[model samples]
Target: MERDLSCSWRARREAGGHAKGGKVTSSDVIMVPQIIPTDSVSVGRAATLALRCTMCHGARGMSEAYTPNLAGQNAEVVYKQLRDLQLGHRKSAIMGLHARNLSDQDMRGLAAYYSYLLRETPPSSLLGQRKAPRIIQVGSPMFNIAPCASCHGGSARKTASSTLEGEPENYIRAQLSAFKDGTRHNDINGQMRSVARQMTPEKVETLAKYYSQR
Candidate 1:
């Protein structure tokens, strides 16, 4: 089915009826142009777009290794990430190269395509049922040193920040590690670095495991 993306506004006539020389009573419906999806392209382009994403994000936009799971993500978020990669605001050696080659339309197409895939939640094992090191708990302090649920759960989760649900444990841990150290420093908001710096190796593992299990 086609989607209609538009904003609706309500209008009403003045109260007290139309005055002699003051006002007029009238109501009307106005149609504003909206950003709607048009089938101006072919399936071949879609297939190629998916293939381009699959080269790193996996065939289904779900990476098994250190890469993130992009399936079922918000289209805007995906588009922003692609733009960040291209602008050097996000650090990804491989992604940077790939994004640089894509046009704005290509990025949008990929984002829209991937946003429809099934979203995978982190494994339950990482949600904190298992025992973890004491240092991690002490150093991190919030969410038992686990950071996924904090920003990605409440109001913060709905924002531009990527959701942690259904992501691979290894990928989460790697990112945390990268943020903690100086290996990755392209966060436009600097939140990742701030959060990662407080985490030690033990904390990283505990949190990673916790998120994995969620």
Candidate 2:
């Protein structure tokens, strides 16, 4: 299984060209619930605002590229990420540039608009508990690793956790690698980074593939 996983991970990396290298960012952004847009948010305004993002994030928030699908994601999560990008807490050249111009209201509107979209990308079970890979569903007790699903999946989903199911495999893998390598420290109090460090590269690839298939 390890051999197969290594081969597949290399193949995907070579073919995808999904992610580049990273640098460690010291995030001082606090973890607080965002004042997300309500149901009354103006979709037209949000659509107009998202026009600048279409080239990379797709016409409707779901990306055919290696980026994540924003449809059906938590509004709070979306707003927080935008805020982080704007504040220089997260490291993304393209995202930082686009986010720099957005006001608080603009971020909320975009968050609400994307969250309101019907989740049809991979048709994963967004409304209920779904089967997950063992590594995500249950962590390695001996390694003191926490399960990914505890905070980012199913009924126990945390307040600011981003949805992972149906994201691109390489995107997931790349982010996990960033966490493991100390190149992404935007996670609250290093929770994700700590868990990721305990996971082997093969395990990371397995987890990424499992979610991508959902």
lDDT (tens digit, per residue) of candidate 1 on 1-214: 3444343222222254343564322222222224323353622365477886676678878877677788877665676677657755457788899888887667666666777778665455655566534442334455334435545664646445666655778988888887777576545345677778876677677767655565
Ten-residue segment with the worst summed lDDT in candidate 1? 24-33
Please state the error at residue 131 of candidate 2 in Å.
5.3
Return the number of clashes found in candidate 2: 0
Alpha-carbon shift of residue 4 in model 2 (angstroms): 46
What is the alpha-carbon lDDT of model 1 when measured against the actual structure?
0.60
Instruction: Kindly provide the TM-score of model 1 when superposed on the true structure, using C-alpha atoms.
Output: 0.65
Error (Å) of candidate 2 at residue 61 is 1.2
Cα lDDT tens digits for candidate 2, 1-214: 0011010001111123333354222322244332454545365688788888888777777775478888888777787788778866677998999999998778878887888876654443653455666778787888888788888887899877889877888889989888889777667767787888888888988888787777
Tell me the TM-score of each prediction against the true structure: 0.65, 0.79
Instruction: List the candidate 2 regions with Cα displacement exceeding 4 Å.
Output: 1-34, 39-41, 121-131
Misplaced by over 4 Å in model 1 are 1-47, 121-147, 154-156
